[model samples]
Target: MKINDYLSHEELKRLISALLVVLGFISIAAFFGFTVVPGLRYQAYTTGESQVQAVQGETGWLDPTEYPVMAKEVIPPIDPKTVMTPNPALMARGKALFAQNCATCHGPEGLGDGAAGKGLTPHPRNFTANAGWKNGTKLEDIYKTLDEGIKGSSMVSYNYLPKKDRMALAHVVQSLGAFDHGASDPKALANLEKLFASAGEVIPNRIPVSRAVTVLCREYAEAHPQPTATTLR
Candidate 1:
C-alpha cells in the first residue's frame, strides 16, 4: 500500500496537532527553568542569608573604641649649672634663626604678635611671657617640643635643627626676659648651664651683624659728617 493511501487525512492532522502541543509544553518548561526559576531562587537565598546575619549580629563590622591609645614620650631634664654661662655666640645664632624661622609668627621681640599672629587662634605662645602651657621649664621640654610637634596647635617639631642649634634656640628663648622677669633663679640658671654643657661643645659665632653695623656707620659718617667752619678775619 502507498503511504498516502494507508494514512487517513483526519488521522494525520490529529497526530500533527498532538506533536505541536508537546513541543509547546517543552518550550514553556525550558523558559521557566533557564530564566524565572534561577532568579527567584537567588533572590530568596540572598534575602534569607541577610536576615539570618542581621538576627545573629554577625555582620563583621569593627568598633573604633576597640583600639588602644598610646601615650606621648617624656623628655629628660637638663642640668642648670652649665647653661648659665650665656654664650653670646649661641644667642646670636639663635637670634638669626629666630628671625628667619620664627619672626613671622612670634614677632621681632617674641611677643607672639607678629603680622601672621593676627590670624592664628590661641595665638602663638608669647615667648616673652614664658607662659608654657605644656609645663616643665626644663631645656629638655623645649627640645622635645622642637623634636616632636604639639597636636592641635601651631607649634610644630623642628627636628631639622641640630641638637646644638636646638639648645641655642632654647637658650635664646630663655634669655628673652620670659624666663627672667625678676631676679634670675640661681637653681634654674645653673641647671640650664649644665644642660648646655652636656649638649657637647658650644656653638660658635657665625653671624657678623656687628661688622655690618660698623661698616654702615663708617660709610654714613664719611658721607654726611657735620662740617667744621674756619672763620676768615
Candidate 2:
C-alpha cells in the first residue's frame, strides 16, 4: 500500500491530460473575454449608423450665426518711406485705449501677461518679448491686425476706429522700442508709392445736414410706406 499504491503511470497520465484540456478551455475563454469580444463591441458601437444619425441630429438645426465668418481681405503694405513719425499725443491716446480695452489680457506695458492672461489656454502674446506671431516690422501689418483680427485667436477687429486713429495706435505699438527696422527697403518704398498712386482718387466732400436729413427721411418713408408725416417730423 506504500509507494506502488500511489498511482499507476497510465492513470496519472490520463488525469494530467484531462486537467490540460480544462486549462486550455479556460485560457481560450479568458482571451475572448478580455480582447476579442470587447474589441468587436467597441467597433460596432463606433461604426454603427446611429453614430452618424446622432451627429446629424446635433448639427441639423444649427443657426447660420453660430458659424463664425473666416473671410480675410487682402492687405496693403505699410509705406515705410511715408511712415509718419510717432506722435506723442496720439501715443498717449493709444495708451488710454490699451488700458481700457487690452490691459485685461495684455499687461499695462503690452507684455501680453496681464492678470487675466494667466487663465488663457494658449496664453497671450508677450509684446515686450519681441515674439510676434504675425511677422513684419512694417506698421501696415499691425494696422491690418487692428482692422481684421488674427483668426482662431482672441484678437478681434477694431474696425470701429478711424483710419488715422488706427495708424496712430500702430505707431504707438511700434514706439515700444521692440521694433527697430532701420529704413524702408528702396524697392519696397518705390512699390508702395506706385500702389498708392495707382489707387482710385477719393473725392473729399461734406453733405449738408438738410440734404442728409432729407435722404434719411425718404429712406424711412420708403421702408414704412404708409407712415404718417408726423412720424418723419
Candidate 3:
C-alpha cells in the first residue's frame, strides 16, 4: 500500500500543488516577519525622531535676566520756588522724563490715549481735558499726587523721584491743559515748600530676583548635601 497504489497521478499532482501553495504562503510570511518588518523597524528607530524635538529644542542659552536692584542714595534738598512754574529748561527735562516713564501710560501729548493705559481700569488721566482731575489741577495738588500715588489707581508713588523732578513733571502736566488751572492753595504750597527745604529722600537697598534665587539654591544645596560612601562611613 504505497501512496501511488491508492492515489491517481492527477490526485498526486493536486496534492503537490496544495503543498506548494502552503509553502509559498509560509515563505511570504517569513519574508515579512524576519526581513521586511525588521528593516522598517530599524529605519524607524535609527532615523526617525520625535516631533517634540522641533518645538522643545533650544537654539541658544536660556539664561534669565537679573531684575534691577536699586542702590541706596541720598537726594539733596530742592527749592520749591524754582520748580513752581514750568521754565524752558525744566519743561525740557520734564518732557524727557515723561517720555521715559509716563509716556507708556500717558499719551505723548498727554491725551490718556497711550497704548499701555488702554487696559487700565479707569484709564490714565487725560491731561488734555480738564474734566476728571483725580487730585485737582493745581500745582500743589498735582505735586501731592505725584509724591503720594492715588489710592485706587494705577498711579504709584513718584516719591522715588527727586522733589525737583516731580515738581517739573507737575508743571508739564499742568501745561498740557489749555483751560485755566486755578491758583494753588496757600497752605498746601507752604507745606510743600517747607518739606522740600527741610528734608531729602533716601533710596533703600534692593536685591535682584535672579540673585536671590541663586542664593537660595546655594543655601539649599549646602543644607542638604548628597551622601557618598565615605560620608556614610
Candidate 4:
C-alpha cells in the first residue's frame, strides 16, 4: 500500500486538527506561566512564604518577653575582686579580642614587644617585668588602665570595649605577669571600691559589636557623603 494510503482525507484532517489543539493548549500554558501567573510556576511560593512566617512566629522572636538580648553583657560596671580571680571562661572570651585589638601593640605574650610598639614613646608594658606600670598590677588598677587608658602615651582608652570584655582583657593581661602583685594596700582598695561604686551597675539589654559597627558606619556615611581617602594612592 502507498504511504499516502495510510489515512483517508477526513482522518488526516482530524489528526492535523488534534495536533493544532494540543499546540494551542501548550502556548496558553506557556503564556500564563511566563507572564500572567505570579507564583503558579514557583511551587506555590506564597504558601511556602506563609510556612516560613509560621515557623518564625512560633519561635517567640517577635515576643517582647523572650529577652534573648539580655544574655550578652555590655559595659556593665563589674566587681574588681571577681575579675582578679583566674576564670578560665572569661579568659577564653578575652583571648580573641586581645589578639585582634591589643596584640599589635602589647604583643601576644604581653611582652611590650609587638611590632607596632617598636617606635612608641613610652613603650608598651612588659607583663613579665612587673615594674612601673602606671596603673599598677592590681585588678581594679588594670581595669582602670583598660577603661581610661594612660596619658602622655600611645595607650588610648579602651572604654569603648564592653565592660565584660574589658574585665576579661584585664585578666588576660594579668595572667601574663610574673607575680600577682599581692592584693593592693588597704587604702588603695578603699579608693578603688569607691571609684567603682560611683560608676554604678549598667544592666545592658544588648551590645552586639557587629550591629553597633554597622549602625555607626551607616551614621558615618550619612554624615560624610563625599569621604576622601587622602592617605591611599
Winning model by lDDT = 3
Write model 1 residue lDDT over 1-233, tens digit each, in one string.
77668677665655665566556556655654454332221001111111211111110112011111122332344444333444766576666666645666677788887775667666777776756646344555555566565676656556544455566667676666545434445665555456544554322222122343345456644654433323111
**Which order, best to worst by TM-score?**
3, 4, 2, 1
Per-residue lDDT over 150-221 for candidate 3, one digit per residue giving the tens place of the 0 to 100 score: 877667667656677778788888889999889788898888888888887775554543465456556644
lDDT of 1: 0.49
What value of lDDT does candidate 2 attain over all alpha carbons? Answer: 0.48
Tens digits of lDDT, candidate 2, 112-221: 77775666656766665555556455666666676676675556565544344455667766666466634556665465346544443221232322343346556644
Q: What is the C-alpha RMSD of each candidate to the true structure, in Å?
A: 37.6, 27.9, 25.7, 23.4
lDDT of each: 0.49, 0.48, 0.64, 0.56
Displacement of residue 88 (Cα, Å) in model 1 is: 1.4
RMSD after Cα superposition, model 2: 27.9
How does model 2 score by TM-score?
0.43
- Which lDDT value does model 3 have at 50? 16
Candidate with better lDDT, 2 vs 4: 4
Each prediction's TM-score versus the true structure: 0.41, 0.43, 0.62, 0.49
Residue 188 alpha-carbon offset, candidate 4, angstroms: 5.7
Clashing pairs in 3: none
Off by over 4 Å in 4: 1-84, 185-233
Candidate 4 residue lDDT tens string, 114-185? 776777788878877778989888777888897787777767666644565667777788778778666867
Residue 144's lDDT within candidate 1 is: 58
